[model samples]
Target: MNHFQDYTNNRSRLARIDASLFFAPTSCTPLENSVLWIAGCRPSSFIRFAYALSGLDIQFHLTDFLEGKRIGDLTTQQMTKFDELQGETIRKERNLCSRLASLQEDIVDQPFASKIFTSKNYEEEDHHYQFENADEALDEHSQHMAGVMEEADELRMKTLKQIVINILEPVQAVEYLAAAKRMRLCFQQWGKKRDHHHSNKLD
Candidate 1:
């Protein structure tokens, strides 16, 4: 895969949960701008919580093995292992929704409340209201990030098509060509709608 496609694929997976953050509660601790909740063993399995964090204006930190100690810390082989663990966690969570009800309740209720109560500082030097307009700024920043991602997706598609042309083997080249064509159709159809929806939210 070309750089853009690979990046876009990864980014798309992350972006899928962008809407979940809407229901997340704000942080109560003034020093900590975000909270990291690790509900599953895999990175993707933690996506819902991540989105929840995003929606709340909190940065979601993945604690799965795949997430590791730092960004780019996991090798491809290690990530594959983490991915398997995450898959298992997701399956169990899906099947045992009732069993995990209390955990979910606590996450949504108590932790959220505490995070907000303790982190409500919006004061500025000389007693000014620095955060009075925070919500509006956040909305604008979200829109800007969404636009950047859209541009990245477009570039990814173009790069992938270029790679498809460079494949020398007839069979391999045909396969990539077909894949590239499908990606193009999917992007052309969904790209504008997605971008517009996100754009309108900032206004």
Candidate 2:
């Protein structure tokens, strides 16, 4: 129950942050913008996020064992159930990925009218490519992609919530959530530093 409350509070905080970032992007630092980009400017790759969480889970278990702590310990049955959930989640993610790939193919395979002119009478214009009804086609495709990506993001959150609320104990869930947040923050910071380093090298 406490974890759920914390989640709700965090969601509200994030909503405010998102609003601020969108409405006043100039006020945000370059590192903040870069972190947001690294975190996915459009739809995030939920599968990759899930894998990272799985790695964290392993590390958490190993850490607990090393510290001889009884807290945040999962039983054999819980572990088995988590494995099943992971498999199911991956299957759903794969379907979403396939849909995205198909949409990409549709755009890539689309045929456009093209012409080439070699004559000097053409005002030096050499080539032209015309895509009829491209706007409508692209708008529809974008809508479809948005819907699929929204569904995927929702699924990702739902799965994480289920794991924290339904599968893990309250204490364990709290610890896991904290660790996950830390990991995400660390990743963002590291990504920002790496981008800065690369930019300096390019200069």
Candidate 3:
């Protein structure tokens, strides 16, 4: 095996070797680039998303993420008003994600539905008849979660934009997006390592 240093005189070939080991998240995903895409999500959109989403880690509750509450005048009055108008949809979205993504089932996560679809009570097979539409239910619930997540992303960006306009000076605000992107990358890498370590332990 030739050492990489052997390619020092061949700068182009050395760069190729270095790049082969590197994975860039900025480029569009193959699924995103497909001409006849079936997933309905556009490739360019996913490219922008994958590159920038980590910049704003907005969860369901706007205030719960990234000290988001401090960004603007997002108040209890606003939340209460939102609930009064679109509370049910928001509730369903939160409920669905909590149930689907949770390792343990929670009653708070199940409001309109009963315990039948809850994964935690699998031992209670007596309720199997109730979840006859388990597959369909899970899919519908998951869509709700996705919708909420997308909305949260919009709100996060909106909040950040306002912060840049109001709170920060012209210079610092300009650098925020790039800084957020780097922070996100670091967080994602650490999360991957942690998950890998946990999986190894399980094995």
* Stretches of candidate 1 exceeding 4 Å from the true structure: 1-130, 166-169, 174-203
Candidate 3 clashes between residue pairs 3 or more apart in a chain or in different chains: 32-43
**Highest TM-score among the candidates is held by which one?**
2
For candidate 2, lDDT tens digit of each residue in 1-203? 45644754554455433422332246444665654421222222332333344443464453443233223446776667677777787777678778877866876554311212224324535454332445555557656655554555456567776676777778766666665566556566766787789899999
**Per-model TM-score on C-alpha atoms:** 0.25, 0.62, 0.34
Model 1 accuracy (lDDT, Cα): 0.39
Over all chains combined, what TM-score does candidate 1 have?
0.25
- Best candidate according to lDDT: 2
Write one digit per residue (lDDT tens) for candidate 1, span 1-203: 46646765665555444522321324222112132222112223233332222232134442332122222233354345445544654564454444334434544464344444442444445554333334443454444444444443544354334323432234534543444345345444465566577779988
Segments of candidate 3 deviating more than 4 angstroms: 1-131, 199-203
| lDDT digits (tens) for residues 50-126 of candidate 3 | 22332332443423333432223334543353334334434544654464355124223554255455676465556
RMSD in angstroms, all models? 17.8, 7.7, 17.5
Model 1 poorest 10 in a row by lDDT: 31-40
